[model samples]
Target: MSAKSRKKNKYNFLMRMRPVLRWVLRLRSTPKAIAGGLGLGTFIAFTPTMGIQLILAVLGATFFNLNRPAAVIPVWITNPITVAPIYTFNYWLGRHIWEGPPLTEVSRQFLEIGRTMARLSFWDIKDQIIAVLSMGRDVLIPLVIGSLAIGLITGILVYLFSYRLLCIFLFRRGKKRLLNNN
Candidate 1:
């Protein structure tokens, strides 16, 4: 359990997994399909919704004729570790798109409201709820629009980049094989 041994073990595990990863990547599919799959997968990954990655990827792949596996792989980008930052970015982008004012003061107001909620009587709580409800729409509307825009732009970029990269790799490899056979 020493730190050095733990590091070595982790490295060994990854090394062992390399072959499986390579085989998955080597599945017979056109480069364009693979690229589209990767792009779509990455795009879907940004959504905060859970348990939908594979379903989205499959549907997207079928509709777009992308490589299912490629499209699915990048969907893990928004997993537990990255979710917070992703959501924060999405919220900020949404606010910007909605032309909303900064939320710093509003967030402080929310924190204060939460702190006071326990001290408030029933009537006070009702008033607080009314206040929040009135303000919530303004804050949320921009967030939704911004997140959708970011997801779409990111997806398209991922698709184009993946497609181009895969194409170049395949083309170069094919040329090398051809030249070697001569």
Candidate 2:
């Protein structure tokens, strides 16, 4: 994309998130709390806990006394639009780490299993296990390890970047207030 188009896209994305973010950025929390919460959320986003990431992030933020929204919002990183790519990459990274079937083979098997699963009833627990096993050994092991590796690395980077940016913003705001008072 062109630079202008990219910037517009970025702006649009932010505007979409404004509702969820309107208060968090305005909160008078410390950089550590905001950044730490963001980091925690980032790590959790990459985990296999798709359905419970937000809850986990919120609980973690509460336990750690971090900024709640900062922790919770990042969990949206694993939303429907992003889930396929994230999980696929996780599986790809995992296979490289743990040694397994190639990406194409595993992805094909996974699709077949997914199709079977769609027709399956919730009561068919045994059938589910068998279907999962048909692809899990190749997908599960690598996914777990790769998810952890990516989560940790990405979380730390997010924390550091957010901390620095927050610090700068707070410093400038404080200085502006001081100048106005003087």
CA lDDT of each candidate? 0.68, 0.79
Off by over 4 Å in 1: 1-25, 99-140
Model 1 lDDT, residue 179, Cα: 100
Worst 10 residues of 2 by lDDT: 128-137
> What is the per-residue lDDT of model 1 for residues 1-182, given as tens digits with 9 covering 90 to 100?
89999999999998997885565458689977887788788778765333465677889899988788887788877643454456557667787667665767545544454444445554453554454345466665664576577778998998787678667767888999999999
- Write out the backbone clash pairs for model 2: none
What's the lDDT for candidate 1?
0.68
TM-score attained by model 1: 0.64
Best by TM-score: 2
lDDT of 2: 0.79
TM-score against native, each model:
0.64, 0.74
- For residues 1-182, could you state the per-residue lDDT of candidate 2 as single tens digits? 89999999999998997765556657778999999999999999997565567778999999999988899878988754466567678888887879877888776665665566567765565675576555556577897788899999999999999899778878887899999999
